[model samples]
Structure formats: C-alpha cells, structure tokens
Target chain A: MFRLLIEKELREIIGSTKFAVSFGVCSILILLAFYLGAANYLASVAQYNAARAENLRQLEGLTDWLAVRDYRIFLPPRPLTTLVSGIANDVGRTIEINGRGDLVAHDSRYGDEPIYAIFRFLDLDFVFQIVLSLFAIVFAYDSINGEKERGTLRLTFANAVPKAHYILAKLIGSYAALAVPLLIPLALGSLLLVVMGIPLSSNEWMRLGVIIATGIAYVGVFLTLSILLSSLTQRSSTSFLMLLVIWVMSVIIVPRGAVLLAGRAVSVPTIEENNAKKGKLNAQLWREDREAMTKFQPSSSSDPQRMASEFQKLMQEMADKRDARMKQLSDRLNEERTNAQQVQRGLAFGIARVSPAATFALATTALAGTSLDLEYLFRDAALAYQQAYAGFMFKKTGVNLSRGMIIMRTESGDPEKPKSINANELPVFTYSERGVSEVMQAVLPDIGLLLLYNVLFFAGAFVAFLRYDLR
Target chain B: MESGQPVFEAIGLTKKYEDETLALDHVSFSVRAGEIFAMLGGNGAGKTTTINLFLNFIEPTEGEARINGIASHKDPLTAKRNVAFVSENVMLYPNFTALQNLDYFSRLGGKTQYSKENYHAVLRRVGLQEEAHTKRLRGFSKGMRQKCGIAIAILKDAPAILLDEPTSGLDPQAGFEFIELLRSLRDDGKSILMSTHDIFRAKEVADVVGIMNRGKLIMQKHAAELAGHDLEELYMKYIAGHIRDAA
Candidate 1:
C-alpha cells in the first residue's frame, strides 16, 4: 500500500509542468556550479604548479655548494570536494613546509579568499537547504488542503482506511518524490568528482552517505511543516502563502537577522584598531628596553676594548628583546581576532540553526570539509610558517624578513644565485576531513534541531487533523 | 437485519457552525432496506445536512447517525463503504476522462482492475452514451455529469445510495427516464434515499415520501397511503401549513 501511494505521489508531482520547470532550473544551476567550480579548481592547480616549476628552475641554476631549501606545501582536493566544496580547497595553501610553527601559522590563512568562496555554494549543501526544501514545500503544501478544494478528501475518507494510515502514506509518498531529484543530481556530481581525479577513501564515502541522510532528514522537516500548515489553513492558496513566508524566514531572514543582532550586541573593532594596538605594544617594549640599556651604558667603564665588547653585547640583547615584544603583540592581536570570530560564529550558528535550511547547509559543509572551521585551520598554518621563516632569516643572515620575502632553497639544488625558492620546502596545507564518527558528533545538534522541527510539525498536524471538520 | 432495524437511521442529529449558525437542528429519520425514500422540502430545508450526517462527512453535534447498523462517525469508513452518493453539482477531476474518473473513484473505494469493459457496462446502466465515456469532464454538461455520477454509484454496488436533486437540470423526458432507472435500481434491492424538489417524480417512483422543514421531518407517509391524494397539493399543504407547527 505504501509503495502504491509513493508511486501515485511521484506521478502527481512529475505530472505537473511546474515540477518539470523547477527541476530543469535546478539542473541548470547545478551544472553551472559544477563547471564554474571545476574551472576555478583547474586554474588554482595551474597557478600553484607554475609557481613550483619556477622554484625548481631557480634551484637547477644554483651551484652544488649552495643548498636550496624550499618551504612550499601542497594539499590535494578530495573527490567529494565538488559536492560540498567545503573550506578544504579554498582556505589552505596547496603546499608549504618550511621549518616554522606549522600549527599556529595554519590558523591564520583560514581558506584562500572568502569572495571567491561560496557565499551561496551550489553543492549538496545548497541543494538540500535551498532547492530540496522548496520542492518539499511545493509537494506537501497542498497535500490535504488541495484535496479539500477538489472535494476529494471527503470522498477519500469515505473508504475503509484509517485516517492515520492515509496521512502517513501521503507524507512518505511526497518525501520519496522529493528525494529522487536531489539524489540523482548529487550522485552524478560525485561521479564527476571521480572523473576529475579526486580520490575518495572509505571514510570520505561514509561522510558522503551521512550527507545524503542529513539531506533526507532536512526534507522530512520541511515536509512535516508543510503538512501541518496545510491542515491549519482552509484554502490551498492560503497554505501555500503561509509556507512561502516560513521558507523566506528560515532561509533568508533568520541567518541575516542573527548577524544583525550579533553586530549590534558586540561591535568588533576595526582592522585599524588591531594594527594600531599591535604597534603600541611593540613600541612600549622597545621603550622599556632602551631605558634599561641607557642605564647600563652610563655605568660602564671607559676602557676602549671593553667598551667595544659591551656595545656589541648590548646591540644583540636589544634585538632579542625587540623580537620577543613583537611576538607578544602579534599574539595579543591574534587572540583578539579569535575571540571576535568565535562570538560571530556562535551568533551566526545560533540564529541560523533555527532554520532547517541553514542546518542542512552547515552540516553538508562540515561533511565536505569546506566550512569556516577548515578555513581557520589553513590560515593558522600559513601564519606559523611565516613566523618560522622570519626567525630563520633573522638568525642566519641578519636580514630583516618581510612577510612576503621569506623564502627557502630545497636540498639537492644548486649552490648560488638561485633567486626563486624550492617549492618542496614549502609546508603543504592539508585538510583533515572529519571522520564519520566525528561528523556525527559535529552534526548532532543540527540533526536534533531538524528532528525537533519534524516532530513539532507532525504533532501539530496530528492534533489538528484529529479534530478537523471533515466537511 | 430486522424489521425494526433501519438500513439508515438518524436520531436528533444536530450541527452548528463554529460561529453558531445552526445548519441542522434536532433532525431524525430512517429508511428501511430496499426501499426508495424521498425527502421533499423547499430551499434551506436542511436536506443536504441530513445527507452529510449519514455519510459521516461532518460529525453531528448531538445524537447519532448510522448506516447499515454501524454508527457513521464511529466507523465512518465501514459505514461510507456501504453507501454511495451523488451531489447536485457532481464535481469530479476535470483533468481526467469520464472513464478515468470512474476508474480512479472505484480504486478509491477499494476496487482495482476496473477494465474498460466493466466501466462501459456500468455507464450503459446509467444511460450514458458510450462515446461520452472517453471525454474529459471539462466539457461535460450537468445532466452528463449526473449520469456519470450514477454510473459510479452503480459500479460501487453500495447497499444504499443517496442522490441530491438527481433530476434538477434534466429535461422533463430525461428526468422521467432517470427516475425509471431509479425504479429498476429499487427492484435490484438497493435501498435509495433521494432529496429532490420534484414532487411528481417522487409520486411516480418513491415507496415512501417525506417533507422536511427547518431541520424537522414535518410529514412522512407511504406513496400508496396518499395514492388518491395529489402529491403536489399535499406538498403545498405541508409547505404552507406545517412549518411553524413543526418548528
């Protein structure tokens, strides 16, 4: 009976030209995203490879006595990256491995560029949260109310079937229809990833499976909501209107509203404040050290050779003190950013999590390794590598290293005049894809929210339906 | 089942809308098995409400309504399965052909494997032309829709059938032909309760006739008991003289 009902529902959905048109639009959007992502991925790969080749060529030109140390890192994109495109490819370096604070520096790069990243990505996250959710509303919004309009509900209930079975069958049937269009496109997209040479390990496959399950759960949430709304509204058109309002609130209004509220509650200091604070702390350290040296100089003996030796020792000590102060200032600035970021992420998640759409989006991104968390990891790694390279330059050559000028020569390279550094020495930025057990832990809250929504709506519908004036 | 047990029964059935407009009030009536019962009344007579109660489409505010010995509301599915109904407008799926509509409805009633041959037989019984069965209801006339509706009732083979103004839009000759068909259904032992304004049609075919006013069964008598009396005159007498007294 359930199978038959599912078939009927699928036929009804597919039979409508509206479903066909919307499906076509969705397919086109997905295809476009896939092409665009693939193009960007290819472009980035080419850029990094070219950079590597330049470094290699420079190494080849150097003399044997001169060792070329490289500090470039390379992290390959996983096969499922195309589906969720999580912060994996966008936030971290392709390759970087110089002897530096790998963990601390990786935190600063936080993915490559937010602008180029998905503000509204077209992966499973987008499909489940935005597209499938809409489809669910369309499918289930009119489930009972439409029958009432057509005078079919009375006719249907006039048979020998329990009302609960009837309503359950309707939900199950509509959900199946909703899932097919989403699953097909996603499966095809994953296959495309394989074709593009992204390796999918067993664990990644498990993560993908969870992503699909989450999608279904999210759809169930929307389906139940629509059913409940339909039961409450007398007219089909009114029900549809109410559902539209809910969708807009959940998908658009909630996330943005939360951001607005968070912004108002706590004003994050501007980048200028961050830089200025850093400057002030560094200056304070230098001032104290200068005073200490001045006192030392005044008391020193006037013997020519002894005075020269003391002057050299004092200069070296001053440099070390300057480095330590700079480190303290940088640490303070980073800590401030981390605190602000934590508050912002907390507010965003708290507000957006109310919406099933946003819940699905966050879950899918986490599964795909393209979330803000991964982006932050990449930034931290890059920052640490930079600091290590700066320290090396300061100690070995006495050259003050700027952020961009720090480079290394790889081993087995020429000895002299190698302008470009070896790519091999760069630290490779790798994204640690969360395992199934870990993903389940990460997404439990979202799952709970979605399930809570489902239960709430279904319960409302059941209560309302039991007392409904069937006439 | 027994002589005293009615095939359809309602006792003090009452309903009021949420805003408290009394649509049906303290209404009660019953029909015996295999009998043709006609409910005759003027506009706003609560005839439709009474029919709805029997079908369990709406719950009665007080008292009880039953079909074939089962309380309609308590066991609506079983009660409704034993009954068929044709409303005045006969709204159907306009997107489906008449045959498809019939097949769809039959399946809803738990009848599958409804071949075209079986549908044509029922359609023929309802006096519908074979060619009209393939046409969508979008182009159907009131009379045509009513015919298709009767065909559905016949296909269900329900123990009792209810028709709301079955001859309202038909020509006099067509109306006569339709009632004649109802007479044959009666012979086939299907109890029928029809609400109609056609007193002459009732005089011609009904075994028992009832006059309702303001949700009360004002008068009920066997057609044979009023055999010599003019039905139209008796109907006018009740319409003009009995409503206030019945209330």
Candidate 2:
C-alpha cells in the first residue's frame, strides 16, 4: 500500500506542469552554480599563481639575501569552496609574512569586487537554502489541506487507510520525487566539473557529496514544515500563507536577525582599537630602544670592524628585548580579542541555528573549509610560514627581520655590479585544507540538527493529522 | 442472517461540534441487508454529519455508529472496511485520470486485486464513457465525477455504501439511471443509506424514508406506509416542526 501511494505521488508530481517548471528552474540554478564555481575557481587559481610569480619576480636581481623582498603567500583556491562559497571570497586571501610583526591579510575578493558582494555567487548552498526550500514549500504547502478542501480527504479517510501510513507515504513520496529529479542536475553539474578539469581531490569530492546530502536534508526540513503547516490548517490558502510567513522568517529573517541581535548584545573590541593600542606601545618601546642604542657608544673602539661588531651586537640585544615585549603585548591583545570574538560568534551562530536554513549554510561552509574559520585558518597557516621564514632570514642575514627594522650593508664591494640572490631556495608555503574526517566532525552537529528538524516536523505533522478535522 | 439483522445501524447517535452546534441529536436508525434507506432533510439538517459518523470521520458525542454490529469509533479501520462512501460533489484528484482515481480509491478500499479491465467494466456499469476513462478528472463534469465515485464504490464491493446528496447534480436521465443502479446494487444485497433533498426520487425508489429537521429524525416510514401519502407535505411539516408534537 505504501509503495503504491509512493508511486502515485511520484506520478502526480512528475505529471504536473508546476513540478516540471520548478524542476527546470532548480536544474538551471544548480548547473549555473557549478559552472560559475568552476569558472571562478579557474580564474582565482590563475590570479593566485600570477601573484606568486610576481612576488618572486620582484626579488630577481637582489645583491644580497637581506635586501630580498616580496615574500607574500596567498590562500589557495579550493575546488569545493567554489561550489559552497561560504566565507571564501569574503575573507582576505593575501598575507604578507615579515619575520616578526602582527600579520594583516588584505585583498579580499569581496573587498576588491563590491559588485559580487551585492549579489553573491549562486552557489549550491544558496540554491538549496533559498530556491529549493521555496520549491519544497510550493510542493507541500497544499498537500493535505488542498485534498481536504477538494473533498477528497473525507473520501480517502472513509476507507480502511490509516492516517499515519497515508501521511508517511506522502512525505516519502514527495521527497523521492523531488530528490530523484534533483540528482539528475547534480550529477550533470559534477560531470561538468570533471570536464572542466577543476581537479578535486578525493577528500574534496567526499565533502561535496556530504554537502549535497546536507542540502537534501535541508530540503526535507522545508517539505516537512510545509506538510506540518498544511495538516494544522483547514484551508490550503491559509496553510500556504502561514507557511510563506514562516519560510520568510526561517530562511531570510532569522539568521540575519539573530546576528544583529547578538551583535547588539555582545560587545567585542574592534580590530582598529586593538591595533591602535599595539601601535602606541610599539612606538614608545622603539623610542626608548633608540635612546639606549644612541647612548651606548663603544669605549676606546678605534678599529672599524670591532666598532661595527659592537654596534651589531647592541642592535641585536635591543631588537630581542623589543621583540619579546611586542610578542607579550601581541599575544595578550590577540587572546583578548579572540576570546571576545569567539563569544560574539558563538552567540550569533547559536541563535541563527534555530533555522534549518542557517544550519545548512553553516554546515556546508564548515565542510568546505570556508566558514568564518577560513580567515583564521589562513592566517594561522601564514604565521607558520612566517616562523619558517624567520629561521631562513636569520640563517642568511644573521639578523631577524621585523616589519620596520632594516639592516643595510655599508661595505659594498662593488656599487655598480648587481648580484641576484637565490630566491628559489625559499621555503614553500603550502596551505592544506582540513581533512575529510575533521570536516565531518565540524559538521556533525549541524547534520544532527537538520535530521532533528526533519524528524520533529514529520512527527508534528503526524500528530496534527491524527487529530485533523477531515470533515 | 436473520430478517432483523442490521448491516448498518445508528444507535442513539448524537454529535455536537466545538461551537456547541448540535449537528446530530439522539438519532437512531438501522438498515438491514439489501435495504435502501433514504434520509430527507434541508440544509444543515445533520444528514452529512450522520454519514461522517458512520464513516468514522468524526466521533459522535452520545452513541455508536455501527457496521456489522461493531462500533465505528471503537474500531474504525475494521468498521470502515465493510463500507464504501460517495460524497455529493465527487471531487477527485484533478491531476489523475478517471481510471487512475478509481484504481487509487479501490486500493484504499482494500480492493487491490482489481485489474484495468475490471476498472473499465465498472466505469461502464456506472455509465461513464470508455473514451473518458483515461481523461483527467479536472475536465470532468459534476455528473461524470459522481458516476466515477459510484464506480469506485462498486469496485470496493463492500457490504454497505453511504451516499451524501448523491443525486444533487444529476440530470433527469442520469438520476433515473442512478435509481435503477441503486436497485441493482440492493438486489446484490448491499445495504445503502443515502441522504438526499430529492423527495420525489426518495419516494420513488427508497424502501424506507427518514425525515430529519434540526438534528432530529422527526418521522420514518416504510414505502408501503407512505404509499398513499405525499412525501413533500410530510417533509415540509417535519422541517417546519408542524409534526414536532407527535415526535
């Protein structure tokens, strides 16, 4: 009986013109997402490679290693990030690594292209969360109440059919109908990626699969929501209007409202204020260090080499002391800011997760390694790279390279002749994505939330339908 | 079964909606095997409510609507299995073909063994055209849809059938054909309880006639007892409470 009902539902939906139209729109959007993502990823890779080549080219004819510049490493584009998007474009991609200083990333895609920010790319996440959710509502909002309004509900119930089985069959049938057609577009999009040579790793493909599964779960939430609303109402129009209002709140208003509310509620120190404080302390320390250096003249130092050696030792000691103080201040301020930001983010996302759409967005982003954590992960990778860089610079120049601290050679052997340093010998800065297992862990809670939503809505609809006034 | 063994019964059945509007009031009736009982009433006369109770679509406040002596509310699924229902308007799934609707409803009624040929024959028996068998119900007229509903009921082959205003939109020819069909069904020993406003048809075909007004069954008579009487006059008197003192 259940199978027959499912078969009927699939036929009914597939035969309807609305389903065909909506399905076509969904296919186009999904395909567009895949196409745009692949194109954007290709463009980003080219831009990233060009930037790296340019950085290396700037260090071409350096006479000494100490004079070598252009050591900026960029965040590499991930294939899945193109499809999911998340915060990949919003976060900065370029970080300049100077041996010792606070690193500030710049050149964010969104910052560079304000036009894209106005209406973000139509990624898979957007399509599933917004467009497909609406389609789910359209498919389900009138399922029960419309039957009642048409006088079919009473006729159906007049038989030996159990209400539970009927409702279950409806849910499963509609989900299968929607999901099975949707898979066609998704498969085509994936094939498109392969044809375009985006080169997704095994781990990336796994994440994409999970993301698609999550999108289905998110869609199930909306389908259940619509059914629940339909069962609770007497008329299809009333059910549809009520569901539309709820959809607007859950998909559009809740996440943004929660963030705004959390922002107003939680007080996180701004980046500018923290930077200003650090700058003020830095200048004060530098002035004191400069005075100490000027006061310490070598006593009875007639030898030029000896005097230079002493000056070098004195500069080294001062730099060490300044570096230590700066480290202490940076660590404390960064810890404080990080703590505040964590609290603020926790509050914001916690409230936003009340909506399954938000849950899906956050989950897909985490799985794709492009949530707010993307910025931190990029910076952390750059910092690790900076550690390696400092060691490399220390070995070559015998002096640590702070942002403003410079060392010049006053004993150039030949002023007219230029020598090129071995820039190719520099350590490669590689940023690896989070492993699939780690991503699964990060997204597990959201997957549970989505499942919970599906279950609760189904159960709610079941209960409401049991008590429904079929007459 | 014995002569008095009722296949369908409403024993002291009463219903009051949430708004405290009494839709049915202590109505007691029974239809034996092969009996054709027609209930006559005006609008909001609790005729549909009574059918709803018998189908277990709504619970009665006071008493039992029974099928085969089993209370409908006590074991609804089992009780409903022995009965088939055809609503007045016969609204079916618009997206489905006439044959599709019949197949779905028959399956719901526990008649999964019905084949396509069986569906076509039954639809023809109900006077629906072979050409319209595969046509979607969205384009079907009121009479056609009603015939489809009767086709579904026939396909169910249950012991009893409930019809609410079953002749409301039928043309005179179709209405007469429906009466003839009901007689054929009765000959096959299917108990039928129908609600209708057509007093003339009720007098013409019904074995027993019931007159209800404001949730109460004011008068009931066998066709033999109503042989020399005017059904319209009695119905008007019952609806207007002119016969209230006698009840």
Candidate 3:
C-alpha cells in the first residue's frame, strides 16, 4: 500500500508540465555553473602564473638581497573554490612579502574586477541556494491541498490507507521525483569538471560530493516545508503564498538580516583606526631615532670603512628597537580587533543558521575552503613565509632585513662590478589548504542543522496531515 | 455476503458541529446486500453528512456508523476496507489516464491482483469508451470523469458502496446509464447507499427510499410500499414539517 501511494505521487509529479519545466531550468543552470566555474578557474590559474612570473622578472637584475623590494606571493586558486565561491573572490589574493612590519594581502579578484563583484559569477552554490530551493517550493507547495481541491483526498482516504503511510509516501515520492532527476544534471556537471581538466584531488572530490549532498538536503528542507504548509492550509494558493513568503525569509532576508543585526550588536575596531594608532607611534619613534642619529659621533682615529660600519651598526640597533615596539603595539591592537570580529562572526552565523539556506552556504563554503577563514589562513600562511624569507635575506646579507636598513655604495671605489643575485634562489612560498578532516569538522554542525530542518519539517507535515480534514 | 445481510449500518448516528449546526441527528439506517437505498433530500438536509460518517471523514458526536459490522470511527481502516466511495463530483488526477486512475485507486483499495484486462473491463462496465481509457483525465467531461470514478469503485469490488449525490450533474442519458449501472451492481450483491435530490430516478431504481430534513430521517419505506404513492409529494411533506419522524 505504501509503495502504491508513492508510485502514484511519482507518476503524478513526473507526468505534470511543471516538473518538465523545472527540471529543464535546473539542468541548464547546473551545467552552466560547471562550465563557467571551469572556465573561471583556468583564467585565474593563468593570471596567477603571470603575476608570479612578473614578480620574478622585476627582481632579475638586483645585485643585493636588500634591494629586492616588491616581492609578492599569491594565493593559489582551488577548483572547488570556483564552484562554491564563498569569500574566495572577495579576499585579496596577492601578498607582498617585504620581511618587515606586517604582511598585507592585496589585489583581490573582486577589487581588480569590480564588475564581477556587482554581478557575481554563476557558481554551483548560487544555483543550489536560490534556484533549486525555489524549484522545491514549486514542486511541493501543492502536494496535499491540491489533492483536496481536486477531490482526490476524499477518494483516497475512502480506502483503508493509514495517514502515516500516505504522508510519508508523499514526502518520499516527491523528494525522489524531484531530487533524483537532479542527479542527471549534477553527474553531467561533474563530468564537465573532468572534461575541462580541472584537477581536483581526492580530498577535494570528497568535499565536492559532500557539497552536493548538502545541497540536496537543503532542497529537502524547502520541499518538506511546502508540504507542511499545504497540509495546514485549505487552499493550494494559500499554501503557495505562505511558502513563497517563507522562502523569501529563509533564502533572502534571514542571513543578511542576521549579519546586519550582529554588526549593530558587536563593535569591532576598524582597520583604519588600528593603522592610525600604529602610524602615530611610528612618527614619535622616528623623531626620537633621528635625534639619536644626529647626536652620534665617529670613533677617534677611525678608518673610513670602520666609521661607516660603526654608524651602520648603531642605525640597525635603533631601527630594531623601534620595529620591536611597533610590532608589540600592532599585535595588541590586531588581537583585540580579531577577538571582537570573532565574536561578531559567531553571533552572525549562529543566528543566520536558523535558515537552512544559510546553513547550506556555510557548510559548502567550509568544504570548498572559501569561507571567511580563508583570509585568516592566507594571512597566517603568508606570515609564516615571511619568517622564512627574512631568514634567507639575513643569510645573504649579514644584517637584519626587517629593520629598515639602508645600503650605500660608492661606484668609483669598486674595481670590479658586483655579480647580480639569482632571483630563483629565494625560498618559495607555498600555501596548503586545510586537510579534509579539519574541514569536515568545521562543516559538520551546519550539515547537521540542515538535516534537522529536513526531519523537523517532514515531521510537521506528517502531523498536520494526520489531522487534516479530507472533506 | 448473504442476501439481506446488512453491509452498511448507521445506528443512532448523531453529529453536532462545533458551530452547533446539528448536521446529523440520531440518523439510523441500514443498507443490506443486494439492495439499493436512496436518501432523497435537498441541500443541507444531512444526506451527505451520513455518508461522511460512514466513510469516517468526520467522527460522529454520538453512536456508530458501521460498515460490515465494523464501527467506522472506532476502526476506520478496517471499516473502510469493506467500502468504496464515489463523491458527487468525482475529481480524479488530471495528469493520469482513465485506466491509470482506476489502477491506482484499485491498488489503494487493496485490490492489487487485478490485471490490465480487468481494468479495461471495469472501465467498459462503467460506460467509459475504449478510446478514452488511455487518455489523460484533464480534458475529461463531467460524465467521463464520473464514469472513471464509478470504474474505480467497481474495480475495488468492495461489498458496500457509498455515493453522495452521484447523479446530480449527469445529463439525462448519462443519468439513465448510471441508474442501469447501479442496478447491475445491486444484482452482483453489492449494497449501495446513494444520496440524491432526484425523486423520479430514486423512484425508478431504489429498492428502499429514505427522505431526510434538517438532520432528521423523517420518512423511509420499501419501493413496494412507495408504489402508487408520489415520492416527490412524500418527500415534500417530510421536508415541509407536515410529516414528522415517520422513519
């Protein structure tokens, strides 16, 4: 009997024109997302390689390590990032490793191409978050009430069917009818990923698989909610309107509203304020250092080279002291701001996760390595690389490279020209993505929330239908 | 299923709505095997309410509506297993064919053993054309949809059938064919309870006739007892408060 009810529901849905149109639209959007993601990834790789090569080219003729300025390291693009695209494009991609002060990433994709920011790329996350959710509503908003309106509800209940079996069958059948067919497009999209030569490692493939699963779970939330509303209302139109409003609230309004609310609730110090404080301290330190430099006297009976070496040593010591004080103040301010931002992020995401759509986005972005953590991860990696680069510079030139040291040379005194340093000899900076286990740990809570939404809405629908008036 | 065995029984069934409308009040009637009982009444006369109680679509405030000796409200699944229902407007799945609708409903009715040939035979029995059997029901006319609904009931093969104003929207020829179909089902020993406002059709086909007014079953008699007496006039007398509690 349960099987028969499900079969009827599947036939009813598949045989309708609404299913055909929704399936077609979903397929096109899915394929388009995959294609565009692949193309976008290829473009980013090319640009990244060019930028790295250009940075190296600029250092080709440098005769000393101290003169090598404007050296930059770039954040490598991941294949999944192009598809999910959470904060991947929003955060800066290039970091100039100066071995001094703080490492600041610059040249973000969105900043470079503001037009893309205005209208973002068509990624899989967008399709699943917005389009598939709407399609879920379109498929199931009339699941129960429409049958009543068509007079089939009375005819169905006139039999020996249990309400539990009937409602369960409706949910399972509608989900199967709508979600199963979607796999065709998804499989084809994955095939497109392969055909386009986007190199996804095994861990990335697993993440992508989880992302698709989460997307389906998210779609289930809307589908079950639609059925719940249908069972609660008498008219199909009323159910549809109610579902539409909910979709708007969950998908459009809730996440943004939560962020705005969090913004108003929590106060994080802005970057400009931190920078200004650092600047004020730097100015006072520089004035005192200049006075100290002016008061320096040369050693008696000194060789010209020894006098120059003595002055260079004093300058390096003062600069080192100044750099240390600035570092201490900067670290303090950054820590305070980071803590506040963490609090604000926790609050925003906690409230936003009330909606399944936000939960889905959070989970997929975490899996794709494109969440807000991407910025922190990049900066941390760059800071670690800065340490290595500074050590290398110290070895090449017997001075602290991060102390703002100035090198002076008299051209006429040299009998032989100095050899240009090899730019390739510099230590390479590599950024590694978070391991699969770590990402899954971060993503599990959101995935659990999505599943909870599905179960709760399905339960609501089941309970509502059990008490529904067939007449 | 012996002859004269009560397949459908309503013993002192009472229904008082939350609004206190008194939809059915102590309505008691029985439909025996191989019998056709017609409840003749106007709108809001508690004719449909009794059928609803028999189907357990609504619970009776007091008393029982029994199908094959099973109280419908107490054990609806078991009671409903022995009964088939045809609504006044037999709306079916518009996206399904006439045969498809029949197949689905029959399966739901626990008659999964029927084959395609059985479905075709039942559709033909209900007077649906062979060509329309495979066509989607969306474009079906009122008569065609009615034929499909009756086919579903026939395919269920339950001993008892309930019809709520089944012939209210049928044309003259369709109504006559429906009457013929009801008689054939009766000959097959299926107890049928139909509610309608059609006095002449009730006179022609019903073995027993009942008239209800304002939640009360005012008049009931065998067709033989109603012979040579105007059923319309009798119905009018019961509805106008002239005849009181002649059940």
Q: Give the candidate order by descending lDDT.
A: 3, 2, 1
Candidate 2: stretches off by over 4 Å = A286-320, A403-405, A412-419, B1-4, B17-20, B242-247
Worst 10 residues of 2 chain A by lDDT: A400-409
Give the i-RMS of model 3 in Å. 0.6
On lDDT, the candidate that comes out on top is: 3
Residue B172 accuracy (lDDT) in model 3? 98
Candidate 1, residues B27-66, lDDT tens digits: the string is 7778877788999998878788888888887888897888
* Model 3 lDDT tens row, B36-154: 99998888889989999999999999999999999999999999999999999998999999888988999899888989999899888888899999999999999999999999998
Residue-level lDDT of model 2, residues A193-241, one tens digit each, is 9999999988888889999999999999999999999999998899899
Q: How far off is residue B107 in model 2, in Å? A: 1.8
Ten residues in sequence with the least summed lDDT for candidate 3 chain A: A405-414
Clashes of each: 59, 0, 0
Chain A TM-score, candidate 2? 0.94
The TM-score that candidate 3 achieves is 0.95
TM-score of each: 0.83, 0.94, 0.95
Fnat per candidate, as a fraction, reads 0.39, 0.79, 0.93
Top DockQ: which candidate number? Answer: 3
